[model samples]
Target: MTANKGLVATAGTELDRLAELYGGALTYEAAVAGGIPIIRTINEGLAPDRIRRVSGILNGTSNYILTAIDQEGLSFDAALKEAQAKGFAEANPIKDVIGIDAAYKLIILTKLIFHRTLSLAQLAPTGIDHLSPRLFAAAKEWGLKIKLLASTWESRGQLNYQVAPVALNPSHPLYQVDGVTNAVVIDSDLVGTSTYLGPGAGGKATANSVLADLASLSRGEQLTGSSACLRIENGRPLTKQRYLVVNPTGLPTGLQFSDRHATSALTPALTPTDLQRLRATNPGLETLALGE
Candidate 1:
């Protein structure tokens, strides 16, 4: 499971050991293709600058649920059930709903994007567990779309990473993304915003990708340098934070919910301390990151 820290670590360890045995070995899962070095190499091929920021919708289950809520007006429970029935979600769906799956993808992407390997613990991920369908309704009323996005970017010389529901205006490229399709948006100076969208489900996509990779390798094409070792720097810090708070509760003195009932806020970013305080006050409080 990508969401499980121990499991992800074990897989990474296996990848490490396997690469030692087989240099050109590749993992062709959609997650790996969408988040790892394959996409990184493509970005480099097209853009002059290396990847400075990477973000996207990494989980099909979560996207399916969000689409159901937004388009079908289904509650979280019903949407989750439908996703499970369609094989979009697992029987035990904790990882998909909670944003941990997306977070794990972000963690893996960070390894290549920032050249830093970060622990899941240090990431302080916030899941969609407590999210209410009302958030979607309110967002729709405001001409915005709600999507669970995982992002890694340089913020004030620090790499900020998180997986959370973020509101996007129609103008943004990701606003139209729906259903089980997956997308990754890379931002760099040369390329303003490069959006890649493809089916995140079905085995055929990954199978084809791996086959293509084998073809490339057989032709003696090496896209990236040796990734045998990682030089990790101090991981990024989440600072100067703000969140769209759901449910009226005791936020910090300076931080407050936008409206009592339903509304919006430009909203100051919450510090990690502020989130800890808010979470302590109300565990069920839901938050959406305002923007990049």
Candidate 2:
């Protein structure tokens, strides 16, 4: 019965233990994605399946800012101001902009689904303030959209996660999730893939989620702690991944690229080592991971 993700996520599952000890249920459906019922979906609907990955546009303020930059060609400051005017952002908006808001949500989900604890220090989230209209424009040249994506996945028996700005191709499920709207794509074994999309904020939206939790309480359901164990790993790509490199100075020497733009280029599938070497070879180059 908490909407404070910062407290719940950072508290290291103690709240869950206390609730179970007191024979009470702790429901936090509103803490993650507003009105999405994602927690219930995972705890009930998708409980039987094995989830491989969970990714989403979790922050309404950041999404609104990025969407404004992409659709209206607005500068970052201008877009953020517009979001505040539209009530999509807070007056300060520091947590939302710096990816801490989304990181908290991701940490909560990781605890519930993967039974792992992740600290913000371990997450090392990347904010969207570094992104510019030029990055969005470059992505558009390849039918892509830039989004502040929060993702968690299992790889080689280890849990890897990250929250950052990603270049999503059109075919991706989250590509069309724009503005203050939120969307979560869950990849599981039995059901394949399931997507949940809706308005991520507002009194009515969050109230609906709160009401759902109340209903579950009325049904006499008690909250329980995760009884499983999982290995947590830092944000690292185990497999090859494509990247969109934006360098106003042009491509780096000895780098092979295709779909070249004036200030950016699409890189082939590269390993983490290759990306590290490329960054060493060329300083100050913005590299965005291309999402599937």
Candidate 3:
């Protein structure tokens, strides 16, 4: 059976069942970013030791809404409604906007990459619902954009995973992705960093992707094998260097200024730990920070 479905676990399970019941091969390819053709290249013989990072923008609805809000100055609600009216969003948008959709996709990608199955229940899922208009304004002030990023990778021997919104600088490739496009950057030891970008939503496009996969299967083409196996090492903790804007009148003493963005104002580089401490002290005022 050939089916072009989205990143819904039900679809995956059903396909597996059908493949088992009929004793025939079940193939899928059109389920990811709209029309992009991504074959599930899983080679059991390949080692996982060579992998580095798996990062990508996995949802089209959130990506579109973010781009509209940032570039067009549309309110989040307005953008969301527009997406719904245009059929870019599901009637029940919670799954798409809240990272459930991305979580499922990540699970599939991880299994294919590592030749090990994983469950969506094991992932740490965070959505973009917490983002505020003020945050968007702050991002604009710093010439950055916010995107919902879902990633899972194995390094050293530990697995790291997250689905959340991140503020990306203009220099990042994700910044260039706008509207309903989806892009993924795979960083590996052999392949420094390879990026794939294309339409990430829409039914017709998704159908095309699935059909392309079926065509390949018909031609007897095989999916690429997994990477070479390696020892999993503990990944280093991430420390962000950020721009913090705080009103000097309210801030406590002992906070050293990293640099001044303007004559009267200062932009201090603060770590997440430092920001947490500052917020704990003063929770009533506004603070701005930038990180890459």
Candidate 4:
């Protein structure tokens, strides 16, 4: 409900206070990212046994910054200042920059998805502050873009949650989201994968989403499906196939690979670790996967 310096702490305390006063008939949702309305759907209707992964883009400020940097060639500082000037960022901007804003939203989302309460401390938070213009340039060269993504996945009783910038290949649906828009992709056992995309941080857009939810409630309908609460046994960890560009100068000695396709493409046998090492050493190397 509130996102001051200690946004997560404030949210936790407020939820507890309201739970006591309202006998757990409490719901909390906020327009933190662009105009996205992330509702805290915690109540008896929740079923802990049915959820698998909760993931989404939870910050409109970062999204806008990245979009501007990629599309308009704006420097990070310039983009951020532009966002602040346009009322997209707060004067302080630490919450959005440090990912505390997204972390708070994830905390609420995870609680609702898992049908259990989790403190903000349980989730690890990362941010896009470390991203440099070099990375953006590299992304452009690699035919990709960078975006800050926040997600939580549970498998075999282990939960992984992080907020960080990621390089999305041209094929990933997320790569297409430009400007201040936001999207959430939820994968579950019953329904497989479902994606919701729209504006993440506008007053009017947020009010529209809230009104839609209210209309559904008035009709005695649920925004989530009946299988929303279903649970599944944690399975294998999800792995993504990624692409990497490397400078031939920094490549380790004796790594044998020929220029099969335009000097940039390598054989598919290269491992992710190898690519990571190459990325670390190569100053201007870029990489991008073909598609999602």
Candidate 5:
């Protein structure tokens, strides 16, 4: 099971059952971040500690596009084209830019860390295609960088996930990660916080991860599986955060702008539900969550 296909980790895949019946190790080291052994690390190294959160820039293509747009002042389409030219992105990079790629990786992490499985439809990730040059300019002025972040955490004892482009301040660990690099920030009760950084793409890097898994099997080490009871709830978490709204044609009725301008504003703390409602009502509105 060296393949990185996301379907293997989805709900009802019965991956654990198949592995058990076959007496084989279920290794998916390259399934998440290309070169980051995140699955193994969480399964073994940090098993004792309770993981509080798993967050990262999991998709290299999306990260590269965002970095190019921010650093070189390239438009979204131009940055994506450049990424394709550099082999950082595919000719059809819809999954990467649309956040579905990261969502798949997040699904795997959620299962490994929290013993939970979620479908792609349940994740419903938000993409980076809507971002404009003005958003990048505003982020730079605010001393922040925008990254397509995939994050999952337990909020009030329930798991909450978000895969979207977020404006992160300088202090964040994943803030400086750029180009085709991947970074995973794991925060646990014992370790407090640990960041793993590496090349996210390229055949060599991905192959190395696959080889590592094969080597583990040769050493008679088998990947573990959990039989924990599954739990699920719909919709994005209700946790509130400030948002950067750009070039809004119409604002949601109750949504207040802290910046005092209609063209652009840093919105007051709002929840995902609020944003969804706003989007449903307001067309041509662009927004990015302000990372804490």
Candidate 6:
């Protein structure tokens, strides 16, 4: 449904159907409507104010591809083939590879966690299809595992979300996650961080979770959800962005290097606004982040 434009109608109808039987719907679709006490609400005796952030690696295809490329030293094409061979990827794999698939899951997630609705066009998702296998291979050498992350957080009562490849160091819980496995990290103000790790086996996992929700709903669990007057952003300036501008020789004035780039990596640092400013300031600076 997310691949098409009728998701809002589909989710609404499913949620209303669930509402007929369960006081609040508990399926993932219902959870997308913010009616269920799923992870967003089911904190273990912890209140809402105590929770700070929710981030997850939600796409199994992307995870599997990256795992093959990084751990198994397969090229992007080979890794993608492997993912398809293992039944982790679709025959037409653009949605999985381009991050649209992850964005839909994130859209469902942002609605559940923040009580706000968002569409694909607004998020303008960034894809990993532009990512260089060389960049990931280098990251692996440095003990950094890259994962496509669906992250959402609240600041000043406004909630924001994004899906992007994140370079995780050893200390990050997501660093150890690989293959088609998925993991979600809920960072709170009190209990610190709780991580949920699972197989993320596409429709199989969805069916399993749906069954679990039915079992929970059978118990007549009741939870109240809140809808607030909140706004959404494509999100912040992304705390960290790794880049390897192909043709730039000397440093751009006032630009401090974030990390030592390998001589051949092709990642770029130009956010749209930054690219505009750079061109206005230094034209012929031939580099841009893949999405932009």
Pick by TM-score: which candidate is best?
2
Alpha-carbon lDDT of model 3:
0.64
Which candidate leads in lDDT? 2
lDDT of 4: 0.60
Worst 10 residues of 2 by lDDT: 221-230
Candidate 2 residue-pair clash tally: 1
Clashing pairs in 6: 244-267
lDDT of 3 at 126: 72
What would the per-residue lDDT of candidate 3 be over residues 1-292, giving only the tens digit for each residue? 2433343334555556575697545555555555655444223222343556677898999998898899889998899999899887877799878888887777666655654445555665677766777667766766778888877676555566667777787777677888788887776675566677888876687777677777766876545436533343222224444543444344434466654333112346666677678667754434533425
Candidate 2 matches the true fold with a TM-score of 0.96
Q: Give the lDDT of residue 23 in candidate 5.
A: 85
List TM-scores for all candidates, in order.
Answer: 0.76, 0.96, 0.77, 0.71, 0.88, 0.75
Candidates sorted on lDDT, descending: 2, 5, 1, 3, 6, 4
- Candidate 5 accuracy as lDDT: 0.80
* Candidate number that wins on lDDT, 2 or 4: 2
lDDT of 2: 0.87
Expressed as tens digits, the lDDT of each residue in 1-292 for candidate 4 is 2332244334654665675686443333444343444452222223333556766777888888888888899888999999999998889888787787887777666555654445555555667776656556656776777777777777556655666677776776677887778887767665567666778766677666566546555665433222233233222124544453444444333345453223344324345566666667656655433333
Q: lDDT tens string, model 5, 123-197?
A: 889989877777787787677799999988876667878788899978989989999899999888889999999
TM-score of candidate 3 against the unseen true structure: 0.77
Q: Which ten residues in a row have the lowest lDDT in candidate 6?
A: 29-38
Query: What digit string (tens of lDDT, one per residue) describes model 2 on residues 1-292?
Result: 8777898889847877787799876788899899898988888888778888899999999999988888898889999999999889999999999999999999998888888889999999999988866678788887889999999998878899999999998889999998899899999889999999998888999999999889999999854333245688768778999999887787765577766877788899999999889888887677899996
| Tens digits of lDDT, candidate 1, 2-67 | 223334432664665566587654333335433223443543454356566777888888889888
